[model samples]
Target: MKKVIIPLALCLITAACGGDENDGKTEPEMKISSCYVVSSSSGQSENFSSPVGMYITSEAGQPYEGSGVWSASYNSGAWAMDKPVYVTKAGKVYAYYPYSSNDSPPVLPLDMTRQTDVLYSRVASPIAPGSVSLSVKLYHALSKLVVSVKGEEVTGLSLSSPVKCRFNICTGEFTDLQSGQVTSTDGRLFVVPHVTVGKEMIITLKSGKQYTYSVDGTEFRAGESYTYEFQLNEDRDKLEILDISVEDWINDNNYNDYLRR
Candidate 1:
């Protein structure tokens, strides 16, 4: 009786071990093969060299649990997610720069002092299942301001603009505006896209003297960049606009030229 029981136990263990190998395996993962930022001015696409956060949602506006960050691989130069993102059903995807962990419809608050570029992208159509590769195209979500000073012993600069704004990652729009000050030392600021009428640009000198100029009638649009070249008079109390140029952020080639003395 003991020998028969041992043989029966061994047979049951063998049968369990020989079951389907693929029974509990997860679905195939969807990988992002290529990601690029498109120039709004030139319609040119530049490959992403850094990591960005992404979110996936179903066609019915339900968020996918597998959403996570993606970055370019050092060896293959392809964008890969930190975790497996299964494309088991039809869904949409959204991506943003300066990755954050907030997975719910990814909204970013404008940090004018950081000078960080805000970018966003969304898939227009629902991606079908079994798609092994995806290509994402991102666009600039905020306007860039480049200020260059000439003939001035400047110490610092700041803009009296809307400092509080909620940037919608999906729609690439800015809302809930509030006015405040944003300071800078290098004369670069990433601001919410809006029209300026009564805002002020403050310039500080080595002597601690400050000058003000009205940023009137200037319109800052999404995906656009503006350069304001200023020349200080002999009195050093006034700033005159030397040049103003508007171009797409990614396609602007003359940005550095404005800083050259």
Candidate 2:
């Protein structure tokens, strides 16, 4: 009777230890199968730059709980996180390029002088557990302005527009607006998406000549590109509007035809 009781006690101890081991085991890490940027106009997909910032929240507008944000770096033609991320429950994922170091929801100030192509993506779905794969697609969040001179060479070009705004990374919204000026020599400027009413484009020639033109009521939208071609008339000392074309930032089929004067 003593031998049987001792053996049973040892068996119970072994079973208890096995149960603790099973409870201590963690869930499998979530995997990101593919991450790429999709062109809003062309529907074409491409890989974004390395090191995109990601944030996972339990719900929309909810703050990230637990460990905080994750960094997804480009590796071997794929985007991967620096460490393992476990999505034990349902949550939403947000990703953006030109990763900001800020832990909170990133709010980027609009700077026309040093413009960059801002890309963002949000996935609002239940990410199941047990080695789940995620596919992310980022889109452009700003408008592109391209100015081309057809007739004469210009020394300087500047735009007097709304240069003040704040871009919210989580919601993909722009707020806090003001008016200012931005100078560009290459005639290419990445600007915040807004209406073009009352905005002015100033061009200075090599002979110290300056011309200012008011842009009409054209609303610049996100992921769109606007091209303005001007022919400098030496005889009249005036700038003639040769053509104005609007296309996607990725340069796809022109949605709007040329507006000629």
Candidate 3:
């Protein structure tokens, strides 16, 4: 299980909310796989879904510097009706903020999703960001998920984890806050959290984008420290399940794939 403590400074002062894009119009994507969420004070974690597009945001809202050497590319497989696209200033896009368009503002593939059937119980972020400096740690987990990011603007093109949970709500859901239902009429598809009358589970992420991703699971367990980052497609969902060590997650080819959709 991963453990974290909301900073005393953040909790005492009027700290702005991170991860969950409560005020923005977009959020990368959040998932709940099979990792455990245990508080440092309690040592408890939860198991949830994992996706590919939310990894960039894991670098935000930390106490140290963050940086990374990874990026999400566009690819196509069984789920895509047409070939997936790699978005750039010169590529065809509609807006560059939400959808991928071959025309219009020519929005790039800024918003993408990848799903998997295998279970990921651990994760590490290479991009960790702070207020002034970013010291990205290689994918590793000695105590918690490590990340490094050092930029004014962070974009969450895609993020994938072995498990997903509200960073603060590692072992449970963030209830009490009223949740507003937002729908994408554009027909883009992604996973969503389950909603209740007074209990709406939401995960705010970096990249200045926040979206809904919910999971219904029971518990989680933790393995030894591990790390890995290889390939990810911004246009598709992803799942990776296997053992890893620092620097091993990226180059190791012995990973087991238990999902094919």
Best by TM-score: 1
Ranking by lDDT: 1, 2, 3
Indicate whether candidate 1 or candidate 2 has the larger TM-score.
1
* Candidate 3 lDDT, 1-261, residue by residue in tens: 889978888875654555444664332222112222222333442221222211222233222212111122223321121222221111111001111223221011111123211111133323211221122111111111112222212222222222232211112222233223322222111222232232312322243443322223411122222232222225323222223242222211211221110
Candidate 3 ranges beyond 4 A from true positions: 1-65, 74-178, 184-192, 198-261
lDDT of 2 by residue, 1-261 (tens): 455445888999999988897775386666777766666545756444467777767755464555457778766777678767776666677777666566455566766666556778844434656535777777778877777667556666677666777877778898887778867665666777888777778877666778877776778888888888888777747788888898877733331111000
What's the TM-score of every candidate structure?
A: 0.81, 0.77, 0.17
Per-residue lDDT of model 1, residues 1-261, tens digit only? 455445888888988888856566477777776776788645755464566677677777667664333333313656667667766788777777767555445566766766566778744324666665777777787777777778556667788777887877777767888877877675666777778877787877666778887888788888887888888887766888999899888644433232121
Winner on TM-score between 2 and 3 is: 2
Candidate 1 overall lDDT versus native: 0.69
Off-target runs (Cα >4 Å) in candidate 1 are 1-6, 23-26, 43-46, 66-76, 122-125, 152-155, 205-208, 251-261
Q: What is the lDDT of residue 92 in candidate 3?
A: 11
Query: Per-model C-alpha lDDT, please?
Result: 0.69, 0.69, 0.23
Superposed by TM-score, candidate 1 places the C-alpha of residue 219 at a distance from the truth, in angstroms, of 1.6
